[model samples]
Target: MPEAYWLYEDGIGEARATLIDDDRILAARIELPGRLRVGTVARARLTEFQLATLDTGEQVMLDRRPPGVTLGSAITVEVVREAIPEPGRAKRARGRMTDATPATGPNLLARITATGVPVRTLRAHEPDLLEQAGWSEVLDEALFGEIAFAGGALRMSPTPAMTLFDVDGDGPLDVLAERAAVAVAHAIRRHGIGGSIGVDFPSVTGKATRQAVAAAIDAHLALPFERTAVNGFGFMQIVRPRPRASLPELLRDDLAAASTRAALRQIERVPATAPNRHRLSGPVGACLDAHPDWLDELVRRTGRTPIFNA
Candidate 1:
């Protein structure tokens, strides 16, 4: 374990946070605009409830049903888990009924600062410390869920139930399984994935190999998680506290938003001394036009109005 600090960068429609350790990204988080963040205290209406499934519609689940805060009651709840959007639907944002003062939670920068860890803020004029650290490659992995390691690769799929890591590669599956286990742990931290996680090793892998693979995950990942032993099927499930959407879920659930923000980041990265006025086309351009404030921000940064193609 090396001394780790956070890198914070402001982008269009999002705040990016990366945990840098040993000159690479150890973990990362993306704070999308309009998200109901964790640790926020707000007044919410208790619309519905069930045994374990809550349908608050506000996408907030109270930590526990308060004694007097029944359905249809207006109450204050401190957010526990932010809303998570998956392929077809979204998960509720979870909160606990609270009597604390109502206030918006700390934003990404604030949250990172509260960690008592050193934070390096990247400004437009500052050298692109983030890009130099393979930020785009991490984003691509989040979008595609494909991670290639030296000996193997892991394909992570975030379903409504759990995020699945299917290990793939050639030759000596048991060896590959162990190697893939390491990669899986790396991907888990790098992509900020939590909640239920399933890792699938080659089925034919021996029992001893399965245990070894499980051990690999334990050795690589930090503690504070509960995991089931690798079964005969080579499947192991690990559960972590999921407070918000993982990097892949944020990028994959809605590609239009992802593309829009990515385009803005690209445009923002242009040299401050570059020529005035730029041309943007297709969906990216259209998405910008759809959000005038974002476009105005771009204009402010680049000092030129954009030319839209079509």
Candidate 2:
């Protein structure tokens, strides 16, 4: 197995943790300030049941309503998935009743340490390891959800029902399907995507070819996921443990927030001695001002207060 390590950067608006294997980013994680994270155990009241179905396509209306759980009752719960922001209405986060003690969930770095991976923390004064590894390229893939591979690319669309991938390219039919399957797997890891995922691959005839497509995903993606075989129509669905919002979800849901984080990252890269070291404008400046803590952190790292026209 190739040795893997995590390059962690504590940024202003977010803290990023990336898994590096063979000198490339194998996976990425981003955590925003004060968000209710996955694995967070806390006492909560049993609110109204959601009208939506679970990622597994199972009806959850009466499922979470087991023996002792009653509506409007106090119950200890653990967050399973964060709230999904749709066009107009947002989907409330999904949670399940838990018996564990109430405690704050692990942060990005904490989660990486829990996996026993060696980590090298990056300081602002130190060399830009993440940038050298194509951080902007990865974020672009997540923000746009168009990820290119050898023969083709996968267009990832995050819907309220599930995240969908459309594999479009030109190549040998069987080879394209197999390659798309692997590319989808890598995109899932690279973007920290989880929950219900669907991939529509090009039609393939032979059963072995279909199996090969599925095998490619199994070989590339790590375990802790359940998937259905490639069906007759060349569609496969995967369900993974979605404890929090994925990287794509974070970037696509809010343009201003994403811009704010990007602005902060840019400011961090400038030398403190520069005349315009901490300058921001437009939505990024306004968004940054709303979050005093993040702005304070930016100053703490760069040693300069921001100049903005918010």
- Runs in model 1 deviating more than 4 A are 1-3, 49-59, 276-281
Over 1-310, each residue of candidate 1 has an lDDT whose tens digit, in order, gives: 3388888988878899898887788888889777777887876677766212223345576666667556777777788888888767777777787789888878989988998889988887778877777888899999888899877788888888999999888988888888888898889889988999999888755667788988899999987788998888878999987888899998887687788887787777777676545556576667776788998887888777755554
TM-score of each: 0.90, 0.86
Where is model 1 poorest over a 10-residue stretch in terms of lDDT?
50-59
| Per-candidate clash tally | 1, 0
Residues 161-192 of candidate 2: C-alpha lDDT, one tens digit per residue: 88999999997989999999999999898887
Off by over 4 Å in 2: 46-63, 66-73, 277-281, 308-310
Every candidate's CA RMSD: 3.1, 4.7
Residue-level error in angstroms, candidate 1, position 38? 0.9
Task: Name the top TM-score candidate.
Answer: 1
Pairs of residues at least 3 apart in sequence or in different chains that clash in candidate 1: 59-93
